[model samples]
Target: MAKRRLGGGLICGLLLAGSVLAAPPTAVIIGTPPQPDWTQLTPAQKSALAPLSKDWDSMESVRKKKWLGIAERYPKMKADEQNRMQERMREWARLTPEQRAKVRDSYKDFNQLPAEQKQTVKEKWKAYLSLPAAERQRLREAGKSVQLLTPPQPEPQVDESLAPAIVGESPASPGAVPQ
Candidate 1:
């Protein structure tokens, strides 16, 4: 009778242990606000972030929150500021992930420069914007070519064993005479 009770208790414990081991982990996110779906956004947010509507659901929560904050502040901005912001949003929406990452890195680098250096960069950008359309196009083309000139990658190794046998070739011997 005592052996029976011990065996039953051991079986119950094994079952409980197996269940605990098989269960998926439950994540508990604290403090961070939930990212809303596109349909969950307010009308003003939808209007302000129209360019990102197609991609809204797929964006990271932090990026969604950042854009939401921008949308919230959109109404208070001046007309020129609103227009600039809209244009930038559209441009941002069009950028590839790699391009966006590069732009973010560049922005971070720019922000870290000293005030005077930042001012110099702004002045240089303004000067570049002031140039003739044709001159700017030429400069852009030159920059693109420079960017395209990356170091060549090494050729991939071929597995001769797995390769298709060439006509008139034998597996046992090289340059074997055909029978």
Candidate 2:
């Protein structure tokens, strides 16, 4: 009986240990970070994100988080890359909501293109960018002119009096002629 009791207790202990080992780990709860006041920004972050200052407080949390992430990375970027980012931010700030939406849609569509097609587009853009400023401006002006020239309209409605002469047929009736 003593040996049996010891075996039972050992089995119970084994079962309890197994159950404890199988239990899930405790969840680690991470609290959302509070939004930073404009004054709280580092000088470098403030300079990098100057274009967005006016609307920063009203920005959604996700957007704020993204901007903050970018700001944190800015100091580490090469000079040219940082300048390009600043230029892009300025341009983005200037865009209207509709224009921004169009850009986002265009970016999504571009990203969905096959790799070969994307490469071709990237090559074409690189070629365009390589052109001189004056040449680019001239190309833009030429495109504007092409767009401004409207396509020819369909033939105008024929006057009933003139229809007889053109069609070689008399008007069906006096009522047929428009006022």
In terms of TM-score, which candidate is strongest?
A: 1
TM-score, cand. 1 vs. native: 0.61
Q: What C-alpha lDDT values do all the predictions have?
A: 0.83, 0.77
| Residue pairs clashing, model 2 | none
Q: Which ten residues in a row have the lowest lDDT in candidate 2?
A: 145-154
Task: Give one digit per residue, the lDDT tens place, for model 1 in 47-129.
Answer: 99999998899998889999999999999999999999999999999999999999898789778777776776677677777
In candidate 1, position 132 carries an lDDT of 91
**How many angstroms is residue 7 displaced in model 1 relative to the true structure, after the best TM-score fit?**
37
Deviation (Å) of 173 in candidate 2: 53
Give the Å error, residue 157, model 1. Answer: 48
Candidate 1 lDDT at 165 equals 58
Please list the Cα RMSD from the true structure of every candidate, rounded to 1 decimal place.
Answer: 12.4, 14.9
lDDT of 2 at 1: 100
Scored by lDDT, the top model is 1
Model 2 compared with the native: what TM-score? Answer: 0.55
